[model samples]
Target: MPDAYSNIHLIVRWLHVIAGITWIGHLYFFNFVNVPLQGSLDDATKKAVNPQLMPRALWWFRWGAMITLLAGLTLFVLTYFYTPGAGFGATSLLMDADGITDRAMWILFGMLLGIIMWFNVWFVIWPIQKKLLTGKVPADQVPAARKKALLASRINTFLSGPMLFGMLAPAHYGTMSFGALLLALGLGVLAIWFSIKSSSRVGKPA
Candidate 1:
């Protein structure tokens, strides 16, 4: 039988995964599907589609992000901070001779990326999107606002791959060698850079 803390952790972890999928799924939909489709549409069509479609999608996207972040943080705290007897305590790891294992390093990197993504969603993307959707953005400012949101969303999509690796690899594969871990990090960074560059050119004319 599982203890109370274990039960809570399990619940929170499940919520985290579910909410993450919702959030990231919508994100991919926006970047991969909606954006291209919007580019193909004329202004009249965009005006018709966006007011109806975007608000509904953005509602799911932002709320999914919020729920995922909350659940993930709860799980992280329950797993690392509260579970001293489990040998996974963050304090114990920090106090050990090695002082923060490679696994912890990967988790930290993933968490940092998650934090940045959350910030971008709430502070940057959501605000501009709200302005555009509500017709508050001036005509001259619309393109800039759209571009800003697009870039931030693209960045999140780019980071999602490596962030998943960082969060999951440690659990599945245990502590990787410093060199191997660095190689993985390098690959992740390169992939994100490539994605950002490619996404930037996606709807542009040849």
Candidate 2:
């Protein structure tokens, strides 16, 4: 039974990693490459290029996000709640059921961040992008709509690094301190900020 559960975990982890890569790859492409490219194009060029490009990319992006989320939740259930042959695993609490372990706290933090990112992708960014793609947004509201999506996407990006820390810290480092998780999150957001600033300088006079 343990072997079976292990196999399931391994397979789902693979799926989660693959889907996460696809989702985050598209996200970075849009942020670092497409945004600048869009600014350089005239309206006619945008009309010709955007329609042809956005839908295909977004299809994979959104679906990847969905798969990653589902896989991640499955893993959480398997790891923290039900353990084959071990009955109630983490929930068994070993010593304390009501107490939150450091590892659990970190994993929960990451899960929260990932869930929020998923919500933003599906509910906020996708809707706004759909409106833009379909020419459904009023001209006066287009910029605001675009801004809203961009902001949500940026927030996700900022959260990604810290989320990784939250997810990985427990597994690798074990018993991560709360302060350490907070520091990792802070650094993660700072890394995103630096990347954005540095990107603004590329392909320009040095």
Candidate 3:
């Protein structure tokens, strides 16, 4: 049987995978389906849909993000704290030391992406969505909230590609270069900042 820590880590990883599926799956649905549907829906349908369905979906979406982050952090801690000879800062090779030399860079990228995703869900998506859900913002204001939500969601999607790429890359390709890591880091940060700008509402209606 696995030790207590190992068992805990395994559970966390399982939960992470489950939560990530829910979160990213809904994210894709929102971007690819919901946004387009909004354009096609009549105002009455939109008003009905946004208040009822959208809020519940957003609740699941945000909570899934929270659980994913928690599970990821738990897994990271388990790896860093208990795993023998494992250096959190230095190189990491959990299984295939010979094949997966890029493990460190991949881990770093995944961690960064997780942070950005968590922030987007909690700080950006949830807040604006709450305003729309409550009566704080009128139906007229939903457009602005939606614009903000969509951009943030799309930003999450954009980061998702590279983040998943980096996460799984080590298993396929060798370690990435310092230049490549820096490029990924820069791109991730830019994606996050640009997303914030897209959703900014200082002077906007909602």
Candidate 4:
């Protein structure tokens, strides 16, 4: 039978996936759909629409990020420290005298990206979004604020591909060449581009 730790990890992993979907979905919506939509709107329309629209979306986006980060960290700890017994034990892989294994390296790499994304969500994107929503940013500063938030969100968007690969690849990624890794990373970014482009074509000629 799977150990309790494994069982718990599975549950948290599931939660992490669900929360991640929510987080990334809204992120894509913001970058792919909302930004362009916002651009076309008159000042009055934006005033009418954005206040109602962004808050509800941001509610999901920010909290989805929070839950995903928490669950992912929990899942990482359980996997990293305790996984040594059934998998390559953390003692051998992470705490050993020589160095860590590729799997551990990948997991840590993914976790780093996730932490950065989470930080961006809380500290950068959300703060600017709040200001814009509440009209706190000065008129001259509004463009810069929007740019900062967009840059942060786009960074998260691009990183997501590699982050997801890092999380999943370690299972089967044993000793893979760095070239292939780089290739996969490129594909991840391209996938983001493709998805965002596809979003524009999806239904609603209105």
Candidate 5:
């Protein structure tokens, strides 16, 4: 029933979802589980745990992000660029329209957030992490590097839910009004911020 392009889209979408799950799963683990655990550790324990644990986790986290981004981009091109009749093809990033459709606006927003998150992971998080993993970071710089990575990771976690909703909402719910879109974005950001703040406080001593 599906054409070759349709079949390919299906496969790429599947890969995108799987890779995204792996990437975000590890992301949440780092922000929620490992960060708190590390906070509770003494210097000696952190020195012991990080050397063994962080490299392995980083490997999965970085590659998962790469795969997800690639696959998602491919799917976006196929669905939007190639198949302009699709709901997402209503607007171009370079072109200004009098009004944009709900589906197009949501997809564009999601893609923009995804791009920023990917950039943070690769350009920001991974580079700082590599310095730490290789011990090339100066003793004085370690805290700054760790904080940079943690903040970026927390920001990605904050963006993930809204990004996912933006990607899926058009297909599942058709289209949302502009007001509804704003409300969704606002609530999503607020909820994620609260979640990150709450999780960060875990494992802290009174």
Candidate 6:
């Protein structure tokens, strides 16, 4: 059996993978299944379907994201920070003794994306969705709520790719310069901000 240290990170990695798969799977489900169904259904059908099925799915979706974030962050700390002296040459890989600055750049990028997603889920998407589901939000607000949720979800989908690349690259790249690390971080943050900011503009109801 692995020691406690190894066991802990292993568990976190496993949880991260599991939760990430759950989150992305449902994301695809919403994009592929729910959105198309929206067009085919009548207004009454939409009202019923959305208030019931959509919210349930979103609960799983957002929590899966949360769990993934927690587990992934924990793993990052344990593997990169807690371990001493560049185990397996992780420092050499990052061009640092601590190995964290390089990894930090990637984690920072991922955290930025996760922050946007969290805001969307908790602030924009959930609030608006509540209105739509509960009919508490003014009829005027329903459209706005829906638009925000859809747009934010799409934005998350767009950010997923580059964020993953940045997070995984240190492991694969052997070593990265401060300049290259900075460049990756800048590009990741810019991509996230642009995607989310652009999403808000396109969805306002006419």
Instruction: Name the top lDDT candidate.
Output: 2
lDDT over C-alpha atoms for residue 121 of model 2? 97
lDDT of 1 by residue, 52-139 (tens): 9998999999999999899988776765566546555465432358777666676777788888888989999999999999889999
* lDDT digits (tens) for residues 84-143 of candidate 3: 444343224544456444665576678788789789989998898888677677778777
TM-scores, all candidates, are 0.84, 0.90, 0.73, 0.86, 0.84, 0.73
Candidate ordering by lDDT (highest first)? 2, 4, 5, 1, 3, 6
Q: Candidate 5 clashing pairs?
A: none
Please give the range of 10 consecutive residues that has the lowest summed lDDT in model 2.
89-98
Highest TM-score among the candidates is held by which one?
A: 2
lDDT of 2: 0.84
Model 5 TM-score, all chains together: 0.84
Name the regions of candidate 5 deviating beyond 4 angstroms. Answer: 83-100, 200-206
Go through the candidates in order and give the C-alpha RMSD of each one to the true structure: 3.8, 2.5, 7.9, 2.9, 4.0, 6.5
lDDT accuracy of residue 179 in candidate 6: 75
Q: Which whole-number lDDT from 0 to 100 does residue 17 have in model 4?
A: 93
Q: How would the candidate models be sorted by TM-score, starting from the highest?
A: 2, 4, 1, 5, 3, 6
Displacement of residue 61 (Cα, Å) in model 4 is 0.9
Q: What are the per-residue Cα lDDT tens digits for candidate 4 across 1-206?
A: 89776688789999999999999899988888887677678989987888899999999999999999999887777766666346544645455565777777777777888899999999999999999988899999988998889999989999998888887877767554687579668988999888767766665466
Q: Please give the TM-score that candidate 6 achieves against the real structure.
A: 0.73
Give me the runs in candidate 1 sitting further than 4 Å from their true place: 84-95, 176-178, 186-206
TM-score, predicted candidate 1 vs. hidden true structure: 0.84
